[model samples]
Target: MTAPVLEMRSIVKTFPGVRALSDVSLTVAPGEVHAICGENGAGKSTLMKVLSGVHPYGSYEGEILFEGSPCAFRDIRASEAQGIVIIHQELALIPYLSIAENIFLGNEHATRGFINWNDTLRHAASLLKRVGLDEHPQTRVADIGVGKQQLVEIAKALAKRVKLLILDEPTAALNDGDSAQLLRLIGELKEQGITSIIISHKLNEIAEVADSVTILRDGRTIETLDVKAGSTTEDRIIRGMVGRDLDHRFPERTPYEGDPGAHPALEVRDWTVHHPIDQQRKVVDGVSVQVRRGEIVGIAGLMGAGRTELAMSVFGRSYGRNISGTVLKDGREIGTRTVPEAVAHGIAYVTEDRKQYGLNLIDTIGRNITLSALSKVARRGVVDEHEETRVAESYRGSMNIKAPTVFEQVGRLSGGNQQKVVLSKWIFAGPDVLILDEPTRGIDVGAKYEIYTVIDRLAAEGKAVIFISSELPELLGMCDRVYTMAAGRLTGEIPRAEATQEVLMRHMTKNTR
Candidate 1:
């Protein structure tokens, strides 16, 4: 009904080792919720950076026409001055600052550099109300969950008088209820004529709120579809994003149906773990789960369902305090109390948060790859650097770690490649059970397929793979059996044949009381 509010024509951007974007173009209607969908490293973020002045003018060859006027923003401030605000995947809030301070930090309303606390609080409070956040403006940013933090970020954007809001993976950390609330807030923003460009991997979320969709692969625009148009569907969008008919995003695996009953390789009895913060709170409430040898067992639940806590506690009691759990390896009471003891008893836990918990970013890839089970390369408390080098080099080739050399920094590598290092490190540890938490969280489709293949191989080798993921489809696809939890309690266990999204959702919400 109206001309496009923004247009990017023939956008081409390149980095040292990768062509981030090539011949990409997009048009966004006024008051439209436009979603940009692609796997990680597909250049969706690059396109947004180009538009938001993050990449800056002349860094890429492109012509951006906003409101029928060609403009080149030199920096983030320049773009923000024009009422364009971008919220990144990792929020940029100052942890020590209060909600009000964070919201009006740069855009502070002051008279001749004089303090204006009351005005700032009032402004921040109004913005918070607009974003449907009930928290007081004086609340500390650190004293909030990730979902509330997201709302605070939105409030910050609203304080900046944002016309075109850009959200990157906004709901990635949110629970189901919080995510639904955010979606509703976006819808309300649309009704108020606020244009939004959202970059996300969750296609269902995009489908719910997006008026139009754009797919990018390897920094190239494949297609942009109007939601009102007849041709828009999840399958169509998936095809455009991945360049293939993705009949199933989750690869089907045969659950443990071969033998009616089989001996579980890893078994736990009366596993009770106290909260690391609050000793009285039982984070893992007397739970028990067993994974058979050569079987993939999935843990599915909402955020804070104790799924991660359970895994961390069982895998060498790495997280919890006052942990009393009985772990039997092949029905043998070996007693895994410490991390080294767990590793010795054939248990490896590849952490969920890969960036923070898994790898040493500053260290070389070789070092991080051989961090666990160093005894293989260490003798008399001195590590054999040669053996470490050889092992790292072998994994680099076998795991297909894309880097010039094994000496390169793990942080310097791409997300997919860093994940390979994590997996390679664990697999080399020689564990009977591998606990992978959110294995493919920030990886691309191609990389995810590779990781799935690795998991498949582990299963084929008769190793118990305990997979924990927030995504139900991922659990249903990769696991022979799925165990759903709620409120730190085991709610239901579904075999592959009976596991459906609907059934899992019901079980996931089983512990409302």
Candidate 2:
């Protein structure tokens, strides 16, 4: 029998007040796609960090064996020297740098004291071609879409002669077409005798590509299943990761039953927004939407279908240029020309890119939660820290933001917890209308259910909700009515009972004038 490619024995990792992982063991075979399935805070990322030497050797208790040889890596450089490379959830490429520069960064080809640009670009071009990326090596990283940037990241790993590749949420930000391409590339890599370990929340993608899956819950190994052996299923994986059988992925709620004649809680009519850079190109063109009180409306579309642009533009004109729109609340026209005005008018937008536009990562969770509504806790131009703590504590409990205290920095929390913090912030603002953009983008299935429940609760309390997501199933499960967008136009609107992946796809791909 062939020996295993990697083995980790009795690994235990701990923080100041929390034991993140306990007695975890993992084994991976050569030239196989291995998947690590776990909920947020279950130590999946921590284990990968330990293996890649992000936490170094002495900081954790573990034994790592790579190709039957015991390994002690003091840093990521040492791991990379052994043909091990990890691509994090966030791409590390500099936006302004050329693709070739980003690909060979820190590992540039040089002849003794002199740098070699010719060899660098030549090698980068070959690597990009190998990964199915057709762009020129000199193209700036910012010029390409997110999907291509992911390919560049893989090309960077290839530049290191990587034998074992680790990807964290590789497809979280990619569209369906891009995700399919990346998965195909992974299969091609397997055919080339390269091993891969992927940490992903997308179970369907795992079922499609993984040869073996290891499940973890609360920092311990639950079980490992062989995919070809007919022992692995999405439900079984969910059961292991969450420590319970998630019979229902979404919370149940009553459908909207508002009167047709009554005005919607929020309405946008003849909304048009042009691209910020391309002055003449329209990003959102004459789109209209209405959300009745206590209703959850969803906008479904492809990657660049203008769903996000429409939401951002409607929310105090945060995005786009040459914007022309009329927003109405309770049948009366309201101005949303700025963020403060939008908030004052009881409108809140939870952005998709949480790290960039939502939370202050360096600040405490308490501060981030109360950032939007400081006046509620302040008096006579004087801020009260004690009252702020009390309010944050209340939200921390209500939102189930798993943390030791509200004083902890927001950056230290998991993706799921960070999302909860963003939600808590908007909820504290007491908005009558909420626009949530990809609220569960990189979170686990268990966390998704919690977020759905929060949305349901908000709708139940008579708040109009506009949910925008790329996943069709989420729209069908949560939204009362779904609108499809194509080429900056509203293609179709389907009631929840009539919505399906097939029907949504047709509308999403429809052509417009």
Candidate 3:
């Protein structure tokens, strides 16, 4: 009925040797919650970048009509000036700064360039309240949980007087409770007449709150459906995303058939690790785990239940201090005191934070894939570029990484492809044991199935896998055996036949001496 709030007419964006977006069009109504769904590399992020001016005006060919006026934004600042703010999946808040300080970091409350702290905190308190966060304004951002940090990010957007807010994978890292809270907040924001365009792989969330759904597939807009019209279900969205019906969320995995009495590929005994900063707090306490050859073992726990801490600490003591652990390979104690030693001991860890810990974003895909095992391609003291190229190319083909070439920058790849690159790096290292933490966190259903296929292949090749995931269904689907962790202790170990959400939850929350 009313004129659309935003409209993009025939948008096209391209990178070297790659057409990221091709003649994409979008329309968003005023004060409506719109959802953008796509498989990785589907040009969803590129379209958003075009609108937010991250791609800028001259970099792409498009006509952007905002509130019935054709406008060209030269940069992100220009878009923000027109009350459009985009929040990335990776939050942009300074950890060490106070919440108030972070909210008003760039746009400060000041008189003649001198910041007025009293006014800043007073205003920040109101914004925090508006977002339903009860924390004090002076509380350090690092001290709070990730959900609160997300709220702080929104408060920062409000500081700029944002009218249109764009969130990319807003709940990718949040737990169930936090995700529910954030969704509720979105509903509240909608009631306040702030339009939101959410880009997420979580279809359930989209179905729950979206007024309209737009699906993209391989650099093109497939279709847009009105969610209130009762035909835009999650399955419908998936079909549009992948161009086919996905009957199952995960690939069918055959039961693992391996010698149970044989020594495990990797084992940890009585592992204990103190917090990196607080030595008195035991982040991982006397935990033991084992993974047999040709088997996928899972670790399940709540957000603060020490699943990630245990995995990181055991992987070359990478996470904690005052660590005491006994690591064994094939029934013999092996020294994994450092990262290099861990790799040498036939162990690899694909970190959960792929951007921060896994891949080198600025480097070429060829370089990133070969980085973990450079010695394999190195001749004498110098690296053989030819050998490196061959290895990277082989992995690029095997992993099905959607890039123009191996020379493409890894940062340019989509979330799923970037994950594939991270996996390729570790697989090239020839590890006997692989620790995958949240391997499919933000990827789509189709991409998730592909990753699951990769994991199955690794197990079939006789490599042990320690899979850690927040989703209980993932654990039940992929793991041959699942171990439950609670308060840094192992509570229960359930086989695939016996593992259920109810059983896992009981163990995940139980207290053990």
lDDT value, candidate 2, whole model: 0.95
> Stretches of candidate 2 above 4 Å error?
none
Worst 10 residues of 2 by lDDT: 106-115
Worst 10 residues of 1 by lDDT: 251-260
Q: Is candidate 1 or candidate 2 better by lDDT?
A: 2
Ranking by TM-score: 2, 3, 1
Runs in model 1 deviating more than 4 A are 112-114, 257-263, 362-366, 373-409, 412-414, 444-446
CA lDDT of every candidate: 0.86, 0.95, 0.93
Per-residue lDDT tens digits for candidate 3, residues 1-513, read 899999999999988898989999999999999999999999988899999999999999879999888879999989998999999999999999999999998799999989999999999999999999999999999999999899999999999999999999999999989999999998999999999999999888998999999899988889999998988888899999999999988788888889978999999999999998889999788999999999999999988889899888878889999999799999999998898899899999999999999988999999999999899999887899999999999999999999988999999889999999999999999999999999999999888999999999999999999999998889999999999998898899999999899999999989765
Compose the digit string of candidate 1's lDDT tens values, residues 263-359: 5788887788888888999888878898888899999998888999998888777888898868888777767777888888889998878888999
lDDT: the better of candidates 2 and 3 = 2
TM-score of each: 0.91, 0.99, 0.98
Top lDDT model: 2
Candidate 2 local Cα displacement, residue 24, angstroms:
1.2
What lDDT score is found at residue 80 in candidate 3?
A: 90
